[model samples]
Target: MRVALKYICEDVDRHGNVRCYVRAPGKRKVRIRALPGTPEFMEEYQAAIATAAEAPLRQADEAKRGSFRHLCIRYYSSAIYKALDGSTRNWLRRALDEIAQEHGAKQVATMQARHVRRLRDAKAEMPAAANQRLKALRALFSWAIEAEETKVNPTIGVKKLRYQSNGHHTWTNEEIQQFCERHTLGTKARLAFDLLRYTTGRREDAPRLGRQHMRDGRVRFRQAKNEHRNPIDIDIPLHPALGESIAAAKVGANLTFLLTEFGKPFTANGFGNKFKDWCRQAGLPHCSAHGVRKATSTALAEAGATPHEIGAITGHTSLKEIERYTKAARRGELASQGMSKLIGKTTA
Candidate 1:
């Protein structure tokens, strides 16, 4: 309709109907009755009106071209799918679907900082969840801007919540010694634990280690985290217990070091479940395969290994991360030393 509709905003009428009011000079006010009046429905109705009002303006701006749906499809096809691994790509796809439903497809060109804030607020209870959503949205908008689909990125102004680190559980020296004593070699779970405690490799990387990685009296392999393709050389003499375990678990060509009951490479979650079961059988407190990495780091620092030396073996690129691991170990050692001195003085 070629009517000069001036949107005067929306309100709930006496009959509890959502009525969107628009005015035109020398004409009766046009009232569009929306669905039952609720805060959410009312907001959606108002947004719909705003979107319709802005359509002509958006069409005029050649720079603001595609809808949110079009941009999202382009983003997934272009860079996002390729950049993310399988598990992560699945998560981003699910989050993007929810975002599209809440905010209409056509509102991409008209999206502002407020819309980003709304999305963030909606996901506020779970900061990590919110951050992931924001990251995916930001990446989509960035692609849109680069592809000349939009002039500006509305997500630029959205702030991220500060991340608080909740430290993972690590095995105590007594616990580690007891667990090792209880668990014997030849078992897949025990072998996996032995390798993790010694090498400090990630759970994913542990299965990938093979006879080829063991050479020149050192274990060498590229880290999966950065895919830097630089081999980490570990000089810490391989423990005889771990050595025997590896030798026993040796597989023929075309097989990984660690495998599920089905004789295939252990998927990350499958390995974790087996590790947890092993811990339970050994009567050890709940500790993850990743905890072995922390335990190894602590053990190295306690044995007077320098941060740089530890980083080389652990494949840590930065000294800061090394210090954090060592500092936690140091704190426990220092506290024990102080208590020993106090006890000795009192007894003497």
Candidate 2:
């Protein structure tokens, strides 16, 4: 009997036997391995259909030659783009894709600095996002120039919007205590807190931590940002507080210390969202994982650690970045020292 089912196909072999398979768009064909009309056949067919549903949609046809889309497509396949870190590639692709979607039909050689400024000014409400778009366009055109795809860089001379604001909020001692009281030791929340607080790792680096990183009483791991281009290997002594939390949590033989409820290692974004939920539950809605890192830097500076010393722990290559993190603490420390010198109490 001939059966009619969606995504199901049958081919007769030379031996007069028919093989059934589930052939879905954008997905590999899976052999049903069961006779048609059986439960097994339907089960496998359903699974293949689901897989196809989850597969990314096929992209539109390639743009005409010398179009903006064509240029972006070439840039995407270039060695320069491929060499970028995974996160960087993803973000850059997203930014460029948005531009290509809007202006893909335009000639790449005709783009001017005014067009770049227009794109940047469109997101004027969000200065950071505007700057990011400009930054992505600059990189794309720069590569195109190097590859001889185009002679002009439209992004040239486009200034990023200036906005004054402190970055992530630095967690206060009281906020830390509140979170600690809410999420006691032996809990994942507390473990996450200690990891960021004591290790000075960014949110992106936290999910990568595991027992493998522990060696010679120090935690050693490469920072995730710009890892492929300029890897920064951090090797710092483990703090007793973090060690206590890790021990209390009783992390099993997982490759990573932090795991989702499904027992899989967390993606960076996933970990950050989960950490945010943990903070909310602790009644510290404003506290974040990065705030802990800032707090660590401030604490270290207040404890008389030099900028270089803070840089060593935080994996910061620039002294200016370390200074920004410890700015308030440094001011307080200098004030105290200045007063001491004036009062002749420097010896004490």
Candidate 3:
């Protein structure tokens, strides 16, 4: 029996049973314990290849292939997509799916400016989703152009949707206290809340943060979002209150500070769902994991922490972002002080 030179690797088990595996880079191996040239062998091989076809970027030469879907496939397989954290990749995947479903059959070169705007406008109601989709499209075409899969990037000039509010709402001190009262000292909700409020860690990084990240009186971890482009190393000094909550939760040697009912590490998305439930229980439906992060930033800025100082704890590489919060805090202080002076003058 003659086996093809590619995708199939022959190996033997310790029990002396021989097997053929369908091997693809960055994918799990599929074993078919059948001899080559048999119908069973062909069947398994075709099935495995079909499954492998769904994953992008495995074939180094595929960048030059087919349509928008092909470009996205290559994009997904590229180092850029691989570099994203789980949550980011999940969003990118949805964006890619949206792009492929709409214009996948079209040639990459045919994606003009108007076409890009059309896609962006379609998602105008959800401004954030629209912007994120545009981001994914930009990444895809940018990769396509650089990879020589396309001549131009249509998403390059397309503007993001204009929304009224800033990204996430900051939690108030009163709301924080209310949440604390409901969740209590020893509960997982309190621990999780403090982990964000004190450490200034994003939701994606917060649940994953554990005792392992703690060393020399600081908790350290890399920021997961867009890590390839602007990787951030967050080293926050351990806060005494957060430390107390950690002990109260009996976090133990469980590696992660927060665990599921089954004693496994909480995934970013899973923790978010649970956290939402915790918020609802506390009658704070408007609150979010990111809101707490913003709250901490606002608190620090209001207390006169510099932008760089705030960025250091929050792992925000962009000073502009840090400054936006600082500027807002400064305005609030100015308004209060100015009003106080006016009232004092009136009384005198």
Candidate 4:
């Protein structure tokens, strides 16, 4: 069999066992055990491609001692960065890589808090992005200080930009109805929507969910985020709507309720992008999977559920996090009840 993917090499051993490896330049050959073209194989292949893609830049950074890129190269190899979760590591890597590309040649020792502040301010137009960049820089510099790669942490005094934002837009009741009316019960879009709405799981958690997580009319799983540091286990009773959607949609022997068009499970980022396309097709350009989670919290809050009660469904670890989700709804519900009592007092 012929393989067309770049840098992929396959060998047949004397006993006729097929061995595959990704042999990219400047990096050690990584063995890929899964059969070619399978979902597992492609996942491993894509990861190898990403690591190999960094080889060229890493090689260049090695020659420039004490430079920012050199520091980044060291940071990437550090245990601190490796300890992060996959999605977090990817997010931080993209931010740091962009910074290194622009200012790779600068000396690490010269990066003061002022310099870091300037970088933060330069991206002020996008406050969230600016804050994210600042956060990535702080982590990099903190790691460098601990490793003795640098003396001082330049991001010590730097603060993230303040912005008034409600974060992801929560889907309204009307919007939910609109989406349901458009997608119907048996469609993949509806199942995806139902999972988001009823389970209230994060986008990353959705891909990992399957029949294995369901038992006795409840779904239980640990959140993907910070599972290593502070694991939060959530067990939510299955919603009738979600159960109906699952039965209506096509379910094969696959472990997950949602699978790619290729009949394989989705990566977190991949599913999010696919969900966006589904939303667009339903004429919901602004609504998203995260928004549905927020909507679930809002519904519970408006129904007079306490913050702790809401946290049970959302798997929020702190009262503060749940409050952020339910504050508006709670206030409105309280005001409505107060006004109804005041009207009764006046009539009496």
TM-score of every model versus the real structure = 0.66, 0.80, 0.78, 0.87
RMSD of 1: 19.2
Count of steric clashes across candidates, in order: 0, 0, 0, 0
> What's model 1's overall lDDT?
0.68
Tens-digit per-residue lDDT, 274-345, candidate 3 = 998999999999889999999999999999999999988888778988998899899977998889989847
- Could you tell me how far off, in angstroms, the CA of residue 138 lies in candidate 3 after the best superposition? 1.0
lDDT of 2 by residue, 160-249 (tens): 999986888899999999999999999999999898888899887888789988877899988888887999999999888888899999
Candidate 2: Cα lDDT at 257: 88
Mark the regions of model 4 whose C-alpha exceeds 4 Å error after superposition: 1-26, 29-45, 58-60, 340-348
RMSD (Cα, Å) for all candidates, in order, is 19.2, 9.1, 9.2, 3.7
Q: At residue 302, give the lDDT of candidate 3.
A: 91
Q: CA lDDT of each candidate?
A: 0.68, 0.83, 0.79, 0.83
> Whose TM-score is greatest here?
4
User: Residue 293 of candidate 2: its Cα lDDT?
Assistant: 91
lDDT of 3: 0.79
Lowest summed lDDT window (length 10), candidate 4: 34-43
| TM-score between candidate 3 and the true structure | 0.78
